[model samples]
Target: MSSVNYYSPEGLQKLKDELQDLKIRGRAKAAEDLREARDKGDLSENAEYDAAKDAQGLLELKISKLEEIVGNARVLDETNLDLTKVLIMSKVKLKNLKNNMVLDYLLVAEEEANLAAGKISVKSPIGKGLLGKKAGDTAEIIVPAGKLQFEILEISR
Candidate 1:
């Protein structure tokens, strides 16, 4: 089954651009490599040619997978997002109840998740637990370490 993934406008555009690059420059580079390898003589003993062919195959597979992802992606408009609860594309602030530490995160698609940037994938344990949670609500999320409680402080687009 092909499940659709949500992305912001910028994120969607990045995917499109990457796909275009792979289709154009990436394919061209692979073809050039194959041609260079083929010129190295005797196909039966051409290790370079075999390696080049394998590289091209891997590149094509990557391109195909990217095309599928781009085709199934849906762009989400942040301007129209509902801030009543935590959701994909929502910037959320939470307080760790036990540690009293506050953290900010932007819930996003799996491809867009970056820990340093505070963007967490909705598929993540904390992100999943935060989904549909409103301000003042406490979420008990289970992680690899253990279960932890967080209080939703705010939610914004």
Candidate 2:
């Protein structure tokens, strides 16, 4: 089964760009490495050639995986965002029920999620719990530590 993931227009473009880079620059670099390794001598015991071939294989696998992600990515239009509830691409302000600490986060795709930027993946425990919730609603998220209760303070596009 394939996991359906959402992506903003910008995010999708980034994926395309990365794919292009891998197909072009990455392929060229791998070819150069392979050529240099082949010049080093015997194929049976050439560690450099083996390593280079392995790297090429891994690079190709990465490229294919990235292509699959791009092919399945759905771009979400922000102009039509429904602010009545929390959903993908929604920026939410939440308060911890126990500590009263407020936090802001943008719920996005797994690929776009960045904890340092306060962006959470829609598949994350907190994001999943927050989905479809409205302001004043409480979300019960199950994390590695335990159940975390958060009050939805605000929701925005």
Candidate 1 error regions (>4 Å): 78-81
Instruction: Pick the TM-score winner.
Output: 2
Write down the TM-score of every candidate.
Answer: 0.93, 0.95
* Tens digit of per-residue lDDT, candidate 1, span 60-93: 9999998998899999866776779898999999
Q: lDDT by residue for model 2 over 1-157, one digit each (tens)?
A: 3666788888889889999999999999999999999999998999999999999999999999998898888888667777789999999999999899999999999988999999999998998999999999999988999999999999987
Global lDDT of each model?
0.92, 0.92
Model 2, position 103: C-alpha lDDT score: 99
Least accurate 10 contiguous residues by lDDT in model 2 = 1-10
Candidate 2 lDDT (Cα, 0 to 1): 0.92
lDDT of 2 at 40: 91
Cα error, candidate 2, residue 37 (Å): 0.5
Model 2 CA deviation exceeding 4 Å by range = 1-3, 79-81
What clash pairs does model 1 have? none
